[model samples]
Target: MSDSPDDSGALHLKHVLAAAGVTDLTDVFAIRHTAKNDGLPDLWTASPEAVLAYTREQDSRFRVFPENPPRSWLVFMDDGSHEGAHRSRFYGAYENDGEALSERTELNRSFHIKASPLLAAMKNRLVVEWTAPRRWHRRGTLAGDFRVLEIADPQVIPFVGYDKVRLTYQRLKAIVDDPHYSRWHSALSAVKGIYLISDTSNGKQYVGKADGGGGILGRWSAYAHNGHGWNKELAALPKGQCEHFIFSILRVFGPEAIQRQVDEAEGHFKEALLTRGKFGYNAN
Candidate 1:
């Protein structure tokens, strides 16, 4: 293992390990890289041992090996100076060959820095380590960290599919009132067939294609009410929280057949939400 300053002149390290295959550790692990100080690319590494040592030094936490030979292990690191301190920003290690550890595996585990707590404490350098639990799986570890940054807020517009449709009933109720409502009202009437936004627990927000249309209400309602439908779903949901908002809508298909339009619109919405890190639905 070796350490050096990266392009931004931040201290970074890399590790190399002689392991069997990639799938030897945990099923899936993430690497978080933060800075020893506040900045970008705070985490860096090129090897597994480096990741392990970094995590141990930074957090001083470890888990007992599970398998006879220890299928996988992970390391987490941060640059903030605090004994046993947690930082939201950190790095992680994963098995080398793209293998991940199964959560079902019984392994003695402990954590020095919970991701949320770590993110709350420090804004400096951080890193993490992850391992898989299969011998035939990938080998080695992957390293990276996290950093806080600001992004520009997108310009959004409200979409009213049916001007005549009243908001008196719940939003889904309004949609169920008329199939034609989908034809006129869209999250993005300005764009043509694109309806990208939907109402969720957090008001108007981007939803996946699978969660697009009025389907979002159904799925969420199912989960919220222990499998209920319609009014019952709404009744079961926390009161005053079912209100939906129009975050942004896009119309990619213009005056196409209804089926074709649904397919196209759903695809476009899925692509858009995915690009923004909002993968909420199970497409399958």
Candidate 2:
């Protein structure tokens, strides 16, 4: 948020933009921060964009793709207006599309901002402190509107591990919500090990493991996808009951670990939790 001069006493959007291949500030597109609003979807709202400065192409429209400004967006999330809270999220980054805009015009609205190069190795690592909060407070096609007054190279916030952590079912779903889960891939579903599912309402714990192709991510994805995860104990319950369950990893194993080893580990956890111990729910 510093105001240090950049040859003009004050840096405009064009100065920092040049670093990201966006020479013209006019070509920028921004979405109103809909976190506190009703029109936007849950993905746009619940996302940490309000405090993280994440750029999105979800409900965006453009006249056409151009060259100098690049067919990409130096997207800025509106930082003011937190539904009367009136504070800034103060985060920014380059949200470029790896694919050609011309090829994507015919695709779905969700397909607009792929930034494939940043998906794997980069993994949304372009987050930077572009400018001080309150700068891009409003939407406009003017020079100062979408301009970034500062740029601090960028930093990476990676997903470290799985042990010593517990999660609600909703949080588990949030981690693998597709576009914003690069950090989760390393810390979550990729973890294959014995897990515990506890019904917060009844205190029943179910033990399981994922030694399949998807590892822990693969196993939990079953729950995320269908709620029951094909378990007899879970299937007997009504739909949406899975959302009330709290999930946690009891242990982790290597991807190359054999199914028998995982099955044995799962058995150990099931015995430890004692599904028959009045608080357990293991049918096997």
lDDT of 1 by residue, 80-129 (tens): 32343332323333222311333222332222322222222212233222
The ten-residue window of minimal lDDT in model 1 covers 144-153
Predicted candidate 2 versus true structure: per-residue lDDT over 36-104, tens digit per residue: 334332222234542232333332343332222323343433333333433222223334444334543
Q: Cα lDDT of all candidates, in order?
A: 0.33, 0.53
CA shift of 268, model 1, Å: 13
TM-score of each prediction? 0.22, 0.45
Q: Which stretches of candidate 2 lie over 4 Å from their true place?
A: 1-157
Clashes of 2: 2
Best by TM-score: 2
